[model samples]
Target: MGVFVASTRPKVVVTRNLGPETMPLLLERDDVEVVVWPEDTYCDRKWLLENVRGATGLLVMLSDRVDAELLEAAGPSLKVLSTMSVGYEHVPLPELAKRNIRLGYTPDVLTDAVADIAIMLALMASRNAEEVTAVVRNGEWPKRPWSPFMFCGPQLSASTVHPQRTAGFIGFGRIAQATLKRLVPFGLTTCLYAGNPATPADPAADAAHARAFGLPRVARVGLAELAAESDVVFVLAPGGPATRHVVDAAFLRRMKSTAVLVNAARGTLVDTDALVRALRERWIWGAGLDVLEGEPVIHADHPLVKEPRCTLLPHIGSASIETRQGMAKMAAENLLGGVLGHAMPAEFTGTK
Candidate 1:
C-alpha cells in the first residue's frame, strides 16, 4: 500500500455533524481542516460533490454513496475514507481500492446494542405488544371485554408446556453470539446456526461453544433444519447478492407454525412479499423487523406496515445513545488516523 499526503494540512469532508463528542477530534486539530454538512439530515449529493473536490480524507454515514463518480469528484488527493457503519454495502469497495484509498469502519462497537434490539423485537412480537398496544392507543381497548385468550400469544421464556427451547441464528457472528448469550437466562437448551456453505462444519468448536453457553446442543445445520426446529429464528447476517432473499417462500414454509421471526439484519435477506404472505397465511406466529427492503420510503400503506402480526422499528438496532456516541468517537478516530497516515483503530480488511 502507498501512503499519499498533501503539501498542506489535510482537509476532511464529513457528511454529517458527528456531534460534540467527535467534533473536537478534528476541529481541535490544527493539522486538519474539517468541512461538515450543516444539515440535520443526510448531506446533499450536490453539496458533497462540490466540497469533496480538494479533500484528503472523508467521513460518511451509510446513506452516502461512495462510487467511481464520487472518487472522480474527490480527485487523487483523497487518501482515505471512513464510514460510520458496520455494513459497507453503500460503498463500492473496489473503487476505493483502485484509487489506493484506505477504508475504515466501526463494527464491533454496536454488536451488543444490535443484539439487545434483536431480543427486544423477539419479545415484542412474541407477546403481541404492537397490536395490543395499538388497540389501546386507538381507544378500542375500553370497548372490548376481557377474555381467557384476549391477547395471549406465544411465550418466549421456557415453561412447563415447553420444557426445551431452541434458539436459531441465520449468521452466527459477534451479534449472533451476543444474542445467544442473552437468551441463556430464558432457559434455552439448543442453539442452531447456518453458516457459509464454503466453510465446513467444525464439531469441536460447536461443542465448545455449546459448553460455554451451557446449552446441550449446538449444531451447524442446513437452512431447512434451522427453520423447521427453531422456535425463534433471528436473522443477524450480512447483506449482499449471495445472501439476498435467504428467507423466501420456501424457508418461511419450512418454519414451525408456532415460531416467530426476527430480522435485525439487512432487509434484502428476507423477501418482503414472501414475508407478507407468510404472515397473512399464518405460516409463522409473528415477525419483528428493524429494517425493510426500501426503507425511509416505506409508507403507511406498505403491506408490511399494515400487517398487525408484524412489529416494525425504523432500523434502530444500534440507536442507543451510548452506542451512537461510541460509534461517533470511533469514526472520528478512524478519520484522524487515516488523514495523518497512521494506523486506524478499525481499518477495514476486505476479507471474510
Candidate 2:
C-alpha cells in the first residue's frame, strides 16, 4: 500500500485565539497549516490583510469585515470564511458570493445562551435593576425605606387571567422558542409573533412550539397586533433593511402602557431615538436591550443612556464562558470543514 499525502497542506488563518479546547481540533489535521494571530486581541485590518495573503481559509470574528477588498487581498486561494457569531451582517456576503467563498457561522450553538440573557434583560429592565443597584451602592438604601410601589414594575408572572398578560415576539426563531420555554414558568399563556410566515415543511412548528411551551395559543400576527396586545414584547429578529426599526414610534405607540420590551437579538431592529421617546413619554413601560445600534461607539448622551426605564447591556448575550468556547470550537470546525472539502457541521445556507 502506498502512503497517501495531501497534495498541498491548505493554509488556514485564525484571526484570534479560539480558546484552548478548539486549538486541538484544528491541530489534529495533518493536511492543514494553521496560523493563529500572534496577539490575544482583535487583529488589525493591515495585519489581517498581510497575513491572509495566500491563505486557503479565514476564521474571523464579527469585528472583522470580509469585504471585497479583503477577499482580493486574500487572493483566489480563500475558499472559506467562518465567523464566530450568529449574525452575518458584518460580513460582506455579496462580495464573498462573487468570489465563490463558502460561509460558516455559529447559529444554533448560542441560541440557548442568548435566550437566557434575553429573559434576564427583561427581568432586570422591568424591575429597574440598574436603578436599584445604584441606590444601594450610593448608600441611599439606609436613608430611604421601602414603600408600596416605590420601585415596582409590571409583574411578569402575574395571573394569566388578566388580558394584559400577553408576550409578543418580533422575530420568532429557535432562540425565541427557548425564551418562550423559560417564560412559560412565569405564567405566560398568550404569545404573538411577527416574522416570515411558517413554511409547509415546518407547517406546524409554530403551533407545536406553542403547545410545547404550554401557551394557550401562539399565532403569527401582524406587527400591529403584536404591539397592541403584548404586555412584554421581545425583539428577537435579525438586522437588515427589511427588519430595521421594526419597533419604531408607531409600533411603540401601539404597545400597552404597562408593557415591557426586551431586545436580545439585534440593536438595529429598534430605533433608539424612538425607544427613548417611548420611555420618556411613557408610551411603553420600559425596555431591556442587550445589543445597541451603534455599539461601543454609542453616544454617552444617547437618550437611552439617561432613561431610567431602559436597561442596557454591553452586548453580552453570548458572554457565558462555556458558550463562547463552544462557539469558537464550532467556528474552527466550520473553517476546517471548508478547507478539508467536507460539509460544515454548522453551515449557514445564506439569507433566504
Model 1: ten consecutive residues of lowest lDDT: 2-11
Provide the TM-score for each candidate, comma-separated.
0.97, 0.93
- lDDT string for model 1 (175-284, tens) is 99999999999999999999988889999999999899989999999999999999999999999998999999999999989899999999999999999999999999
Q: What lDDT does the true structure give each of the candidates?
A: 0.93, 0.86
Q: Could you give the C-alpha RMSD of every candidate to the true structure, in order shown?
A: 3.9, 3.8
**Taking the tens digit of each residue's C-alpha lDDT, what string does model 2 give over 189-274?**
78888876443324387678777777778888888999999988999988888888888999999998888899998889999889
**Best prediction by lDDT:** 1
Question: Global CA lDDT of candidate 2, please?
Answer: 0.86
Candidate 2 is scored at a TM of 0.93
